[model samples]
Target: MGRRVIALKPLSKENVTSFYQWLNDPEVIRYSLSLFQKLNTEADIDFWYKGVLRDTKTLSLGIYVDEEFVGYAGISSLSSVNKSGEYYIFIGNKDFWSKGVGTEVTRQIIEIAFVEKELERLMLTVSVPNQGGVKAYKKAGFKEEGRLRNAALRDGEFHDKIIMSILKSEYKLS
Candidate 1:
C-alpha cells in the first residue's frame, strides 16, 4: 500500500471544538496523559488555544486520512538546550490504529524535524505498554535510549516511560 503524506498544518479555533470532542472520548484518553486531563471547558479550551497561537517553539499538526481529521501530532523542544526535540501524535480515531497511517504520519513529521528545522536529534517518550507507538517510532528510525521507572501511575500500576531518540545521521528514512 502506498503511504499518503499529509502536510502538517497549524491548529486554530476552527477545529478546536473537534479536537476537544476527540479528547472527551475515554478510548482516546487511554494513552494520552499530556492532554487527557486538560481543558475540558470552553473557556479553558480558549485559553489553551491562545497559548498554542503564541507558542513558537512547538509545531502542531492535524493528521488527516481520506481528507478527514483522524488524529494530531506535534514536535517541541524538550528543553532550553535546543539541540533535541520531542514528538507526540495520536491516531485517536481508534478505528485507524494498526493501519499504517500513524507510521506515515511519523515519517512526515520526523522528516520535517530533520530537513526543515535542521534539528540535531528527535526524541519521544512513551509509556512501556504503548507498543504500537514504539514500533512506529522504531520503524521511522528511533533507537531506544532508556527508561524512566515508575514515572507515572495509571490504572493502579506504575508504568515506566521509554525514552527514545534519533539523530539526523542515523535516520535512513528516505
Candidate 2:
C-alpha cells in the first residue's frame, strides 16, 4: 500500500459545511467533546470559524487528503511562558478513519509544534474508549501523562479521559 498524500492547510470558510456535518455525525462525535456540543447548521459554526481564524494563540488547520477537506487539527491554549499547548484533532471523514491518517497528521502536528513553532511541550486529552485516537497519539510519541476518571459524560454514562503529551526533546521524526 502506498502512503496517502496528506496536507494541512488553513481552515477555510468553505470547510465549515463539512464541519457542520462532522459535528452532527454520531460516529465522529463519539470520541470527542463535540458530542456535547449542539450545532444545528453551518451557521452554528460561524462563531467558531471566526474565532479560530482570529485567535493568535491557536493554530487550527484543515486536514486535506488529495485536496479534499476531511478534518481539522489544532494546537490551542498556547502559553509562551510555559512553552506548551493543548493539541486536538478530528478526522471526521469516516472513509479516512483507521487508515493511518490520524497517525500521520499527529506526526505532522508534533513536528510543527516542536520544531517550526519552537514549543517545548504539546498535550492532548482523549476519551479512554477512543482506542484509535490513543493509538495514533502513542505512535507519534505522545505518552499518557494522566487519566481523569469520569471526565466525559456520554449517553447517560461517564467515561474516563486520558491526558497525553510529547516534549520537544523527546520528538524524533520518523
Q: Pick the candidate with the highest lDDT.
A: 2
Please list the Cα RMSD from the true structure of every candidate, rounded to 1 decimal place.
Answer: 2.4, 1.6
The sequence of per-residue lDDT tens digits that candidate 1 reaches over residues 129-162 is: 8888888888788999999999867667888989
How well does candidate 2 score on lDDT at residue 77? 91
Which residue pairs collide, candidate 1? none
- Give the per-residue Cα lDDT of candidate 1 at 71: 73
Best by TM-score: 2
Q: Give the TM-score of candidate 2.
A: 0.93
TM-score of 1: 0.87
Q: Which stretches of candidate 1 lie over 4 Å from their true place?
A: 1-5, 78-81
